[model samples]
Target: MSPLIELRGVTKSYGDHTVLRGIDLEVAAHEVISLIGASGCGKSTLLRCVNGLETIDGGEIAVDGDVVSGPGVDLVRLRRQVGMVFQSYNLFPHMTVLQNAVLAPVKTGLCSKEEAEERAMAMLGRVGLADRAGSYPDQMSGGQQQRAAIARTMLMSPRILLLDEITSALDPELVIEVLNIVQDLAESGMTMLLTTHEMGFAREISGRVCFLHGGGILEQGPPAQIFDDPAEQRTRDFLRKVSLAGRL
Candidate 1:
């Protein structure tokens, strides 16, 4: 299958500090790939680059055959095909759940309000939030708010989703609810690039697991191989640290 997203020699840095180096990666259509690493290892930065939220200083990023970060790429259009869900439930508190979900399609694509609301209702239902359609973000828990955020992104009908540690900011009990919704999406054939510290979920759900460290991907493979028998010393050591810390 052709890759839904591809990167070649991608690098990103801020002034004197480099966050990613010579990164080459790809996400196949309908595949769920997880990037797992300790804090500050550039996993989140990599996810940002995938969705055009962060600009790379050099190299190329392509999403569905269109250049995303290289010459001649229209980032505005590219982003419409790639949606992002952040750790914080970045919902507009002023809008109801359905309104927040439908805003993007109605504003960016100039879709009719009625059509957008219908699409939004369907997506919110997919995430099991149909009954709460008129609730404001502030009226919900973190889990519900995040689910609303996911629904909002889904209304855009994106082909690829970038999740940047989306559950990190949630209460411990709320994490599983969000993760369960994501797992359902993965099972239903959504192409995803997820960065998370949730090792067990990564091992259980990802088609491939990538380990990043020191501004680069240290090792990557199928979940069984990467989690059980990583090839890189840094990966093994990092796993040990998170494991001993009771994070794995």
Candidate 2:
């Protein structure tokens, strides 16, 4: 079977600064992969490019066989199929959780107002936030807010999820709740590509792991091999440093 997501010679640069140099990857349907690397290694940029949030400077990106990079692409349609959640929990401050989750589907005509609310309520329950549906962002814990953000994304019924350090802004104690939802998503066969600082969770949950260095993929393999037996020296060094920092 062909990959559900494919990148060929992907490159991105911002004036003098370059990120994601010649990245080539393929993600099968239902596969969960984590991109691991040091800061500025272009992991997040790669995800954004995949979602068309950032235009690539070179090469091509195809999702489910549709070319998504370059001009003439319908970004709004692409985004609906490619859900993304950020570290900052970008929930609207004034909207209640239920209202936030229901807005998109109702406005886009994906569902009627009543149907969107029903679906959003069920999704909130799935993320353990049904009781908090009426609460505003400021009234929730960091974990709850992130879960709300995730619920909003999932309600789009995306074919793929791009998580850009979704737990990076949470307290250490709050990280697990978000990760647990990710764990559930993976087990439920949600296709996901994520950039993460949580090495243990990546090792535990990823179908594969890629180590990015100098804006390109340096090594990629099954989690055990990539995390425990990486062949590249840079990969080894990065793992060792993060391990010594108690980040592993």
Candidate 3:
């Protein structure tokens, strides 16, 4: 079977500072992958590129056998199939949680307002935000807001999920609740590609772990091999620093 997501020789840059350089990867259906590395290593950019938020400079990216890179691609369509959750909860401040969750489906004509609300409520309930449906973004804690953002993304029934350091902005105490939700998604066989600093959670939940370094994926393998016995020197050094910092 074709990979659910495919990137070949992908490259991206902002002026001269390239973020991703010839990044190639393949993810299968229901596979969970974690991209781990220091900041500015293109983890977030890679996800953005895949979801059509950032255009690539070179190479090709395909989702489910259809090309998604370069010009003329239907970004809205691409994003619907490949959902993304970012570090910041970008909810509409004026909208209540239920309103925010239903925006995409209703705006895109995917469903009527009533249908969207029902679907959004179910997703909000799944993310443990049932009680917050009537609350605005400012009324919720950081964790709760993030959960609402996740529920908003999931309401579209995306085929693949891209998570970009979803826990970095939250207080440490609130991190567990968000990670628990992601763990539940992983266990439910959601296809995911996530950039994360939560090493332990990534190791515990990812089917495969990829170490991104110097604008490319330096090494990737099963979690045990990548974490315990990685093949690349850079991967070893990176893990050592993470270990020393008590992040691994």
Candidate 4:
């Protein structure tokens, strides 16, 4: 089978400020790849490009062998197969967890309310939030809200899930709850592209890790090699500082 997603020479810029430079990467089906880098290294931009939220200035992006950014691709349809979770849980404050999770499937998949509700309830259980299904965002903790967001994404039955630092905005204690939900998803075969600073989680849960620096992937490999014996000096320095600080 072809790659679930591919980025070929993908470059992006906001006028003179180049955000991404000639990125080439591939994500296989059911694979989890974590993109780790400094704050402005374009990891989120790259994820946005994959889901068609950000258009590329040059190069091509394809999902499951169909070109998304180049000629003859249906962006709208492509996005339906890709779901994105944000750093700030973007739940509708007015909607309950079940409503939030079922809305997209009911609207886009044209499923009956009963079917959507069933799927949403199952997903809530998957994220360990079954009992809180009737709660609104305001009533939930940051971690619960984020997990609800993940369940909302899963309700779409996406082929790929793009996570843009989903735990960055959470409290330290809440971070593990959200990460645990992600770990469950990975274990159960969800294809995920994540931008995160949680190195321990990335190392433990990811199939591969890509280190971005100065707008592109400076180094990438399996967690053990990339975390223990990175080849690039930039990667080594960044890891050292992050590791040291993590100890504090």
Report backbone clashes per prediction: 0, 0, 0, 0
lDDT of 3 by residue, 1-248 (tens): 99999999999999989899999999999999999999899999999999988899999999999999988999889988999999998999999999999999999988999999998888888999998899999999999999999899999889999999998899889988998898899889899999988788789779999999999999999999998999999999988998998878
> Model 4, stretches more than 4 Å misplaced?
70-73
Q: Give the TM-score of candidate 1.
A: 0.96
Sort the predicted structures by lDDT, highest score first.
Answer: 2, 3, 4, 1
Q: What digit string (tens of lDDT, one per residue) describes model 1 on residues 1-248? A: 66889988899999999999999998899999999998988998998888777889988888887778855667668778998999887999899998898888888874889999988888888888999999998889999999999989888888888998888888789988898999899998999999989787788779999998888888999999998898889999988987887667
TM-score of 3: 0.97
TM-score of each: 0.96, 0.98, 0.97, 0.96
Poorest lDDT segment (10 consecutive residues) of candidate 4: 70-79
Q: Write the per-residue lDDT of candidate 4 for residues 1-248, one digit (tens) a residue.
A: 78989999999999999999999999999999999988899999999888888889998998888888955667667767998999998999999999898888778755889999998899899889999999999999999999999999888888899999998888888988988888888988989999988898789779999999998899999999999999999999999988887911
Candidate 3 overall lDDT versus native: 0.93
Q: What is the lDDT of residue 115 in candidate 3?
A: 98
* Top candidate when judged by lDDT against the true structure: 2
CA shift at 51, candidate 1, in angstroms? 1.4
Where does candidate 4 clash, by residue pair?
none
Question: Which stretches of model 2 miss by more than 4 angstroms?
Answer: none
lDDT of 1 at 206: 91
Can you write out model 2's per-residue Cα lDDT over 196-215, one digit (the tens) per residue?
98898799779999999999
